[model samples]
Target chain A: MTNETGAPLLDVSGVTLRYKTPGALITATERVSFAVNRSDRFVLLGPSGCGKSTLLKAVGGYLKPSEGSITILGRKVMEPGPDRMMVFQEFDQLLPWKTVLENVMFPLLDARNLSRKEAEEKARHYIDKVSLTRALHSYPHTLSGGMKQRVAIARGMAMEPDILLMDEPFAALDALTRRTCQDELLQLWEETRFTVMFVTHSINEAIKIGNRILLLSPHPGRVKAEVVDVDTASPTDGSAGQLEKEIHDMLFSQEEAH
Target chain B: MSSKARIVMRPLEDAGSGEVERELSFLEKAWDNSGVRKVAIILALALIWELYGRWTDNALLFPPLSDTFAALIDNIRSGVLPARAWTSLKILLMGYAAGIVMAGILTIAAINTRLGSDFLETMTAMLSPLPAIALLPLALLWFGLGNGSLVFILIHSVLWPVALNTHSGFRAVSTTLRMVGRNYGLKGFAFIRKILIPAAFPSILAGLKIGWAFAWRTLVAAELVFGVSSGQGGLGWFIFENRNLLEIPSVFAGLLTVILIGLIVENLIFRTIERRTVLRWGLQS
Candidate 1:
């Protein structure tokens, strides 16, 4: 699970994302570098608009870095591919027209060289795994908020991507629902051992779900700190709340320093 | 207290609570029954209209609801209204279908290329403000007093709104949805079919509503001026001929039929479809 073999499951090096403005360029993230091993739950922790999601987008191939490069499974990613699936923040990520099962089967239709029967089988498998077997025929609109995210998660997992990138996927749900989904996600990860790069603002969520957390500074986001805690499985019941608060204070100390 | 007294008091209290709960449940059920409520309202309005129309003395001003219904029945039995209605429906469907198809192609093209979008915007801006009825004289000259002329006018009525709404709908689709589409590696028609079309459906339905109204009005006006097409007269022709003969009640009959059809189409067909699709999906309230 190291890059010593000259290959990593996910790799990002010297990545900078900038927006070109009329008078000057606005940088969102600068000099970001990390490599994720196989089955690693890597979390990018930052406040809103800190370019954490932007970095996820960069890895997902939705956006290209202004500088540096990204590679997955030793292949340089210049464009979005089915091999790197993204679970978006919005629940509408699952197409409303599709039933839950169909939504999960969508990528297989486009990405894989599988038959319809094969795709359906695989989709049902993932749907069942997400505890959505009863909702297989239900449309996204009929599902509750937590249910919608479960469908999206099932859709991404069914794609069997080398790396799954989530852009604050549970942020919009209610607190209780978010916690439930967080635990479900952790359980799913334990079962599948899928490589995941999750972006979140909540330090509590980051510590609970991530094996390693990368702290990003606000406004022209940059790497502030990186902590690898291999101690706990996901969905920590506030046991690590003190450690998370410490990280939160350190990251937000800009206001205090000023 | 005596055991007999306690038994009577407890039973009486339970009965009272049960009755109140039952009434509350009924009210709750009624609150949830929106579809039933809507139907009831429509029926009540129709009844009121019928009663009012019958009470009116002037046949020229307000033909009794019975008279309108009887006239509609007579025309249908005589094969007059059906033939004419069929003709109108044919032209309407043809021109409407063609307009929608062309608009869809144009919107897709517009989304893909900057030049196409620019051209579409300019063309829609130029045409949308100009009434479709205004194009009749030119259409008559070009297509020469037939179904072709009516179709040309119909196209003028239907095209711009569909194209404009579709283009905007495509533009309005959230980037997140688009990214999800791309993540699946869908390109070209596949992407549009799976993502753009469904995401843009609400706006497209609105465009369809506008297009239908525009086409309906334009068809009637065109037929009034042009008379008939391919020797087959439609509802518009029936109205025009009745007016020329100064048959006021018959003209009222034709007008009433038109209004009825419009209402039926709007409330029953289009709205039903909208409810089952966008509204049911919770994409639209």
Candidate 2:
């Protein structure tokens, strides 16, 4: 699949993101470059301060890179658009006032220009995909944390964007629920083969979810290495453990050196 | 898996294992009901007021609860108190509606632009602390002693709290929610209507409640002065007139009517809105 790629679906090149704090100009990521092909389950794996989430935000067009460019399907992303839908880590990402169905349907009606009936039909399809059909009328607050995340996923998938951007999507869930959610996400990907740029600090999650994983270094995040053929590293097997240990050593060895 | 010693276990009791449904005692049931508790409190307060009035035995200063009730019933029958209350309510509604509309515009402005936000902050800081009643003399001079003057002061009282609360509410909206709204390409008024308004509704409802209380009291106070000059006013005028005539029971009745109106608005109007929107949406308790 890597050799078969043609001009990669989304190209992010040498992007640097910085923001001004009270007293200092903090760099979130510096000169990070990567390409996500069509239907690629691309994962950004790093420590908490590595700014993988910031890169995802830049890709989502919520933040502009201080240098370099991010282009989706040959167009530079200048601002947030419906082409890239994001499933946020925070449970409050789903509109509290909207029921599960409405939350999913909102972007469709708002940006996709679909008729109300069409939006509802499309929304219900995605909602059912997430196995939240029974909770179609329930508000976000009424749902459990895992259920809320599912609803958020449903809302994002309903948009059917060029690429889905996820920022530590299941990071807030309980351990058991998190595993189930990760499995569900993989199952959904298997069915649809939708391109996703998933950001996570968990090694297991990165290996399990991404076919290609980009390892990043801590603070002022820079691309450390890129690991390919991750889809072959099954989590239950010895190779997955070996891969996990390799990624961990690469991430923490710099800290020891410093 | 067989052990050396055999253990005997009792079968689980199905009846006791499930949830138990037991009827509450009559007094316990009554106390548990909110409406019943509220009514009980009101009755207890009425009893205390009656006892105190009787103990004092000064009808001119403090009419007994029973005498006040009689006067209230008499005025209702005569259509005097009803007319006065209706007049006050009409002016109050006008002012409240105008104030809310203006506050909405100001809040939208504050959310959209830096200058508008600064303007709102400055205006609220400068004007919110100034009592609406204090503006009555200027209002009287500008709008004359009528409904116009009364509404002017009412707007003054209602506008600031509503604007300030709404602005704060908008500012407090979660970053994630804002990003979601922007991700959908929602801009300006549509953004406010869809994301900001519902997200900020609980605080906005609080603002509405504060604004209502301020507007109600300001109207009454403004009417007191307005009645003296205009020769026609609302509930405040009714109370002042009765006081002049030395009809202490009627004066107490007028004051009771003011409290009744306040209770009706707070419980009926605002509570219904809160229940339908904020509470139902789980934005507030």
The numbered model that scores best in DockQ is 2
How much is the lDDT of residue A241 in candidate 2? 97
Q: Which CAPRI category fits model 1?
A: medium
lDDT of 1 by residue, B72-115 (tens): 78877998887887898899989999899989988988999999
All models, RMSD in angstroms: 5.6, 3.0
**Model 2 residue B136 lDDT score:** 85
In candidate 2, which residue pairs clash?
none
Clashing pairs in 1: none
DockQ for every model, please: 0.64, 0.73
Once fitted onto the true fold, the runs of candidate 1 whose alpha carbons sit more than 4 angstroms away are A1-6, A21-24, A232-242, B1-65
What interface Cα RMSD is found for model 1? 1.4
lDDT of 1 by residue, A184-256 (tens): 9989998999999999998888888899999898778888888887346333565476676688789888857
Model 2: number of backbone collisions: 0
**What C-alpha root-mean-square deviation, in Å, does candidate 1 show against the real structure?**
5.6
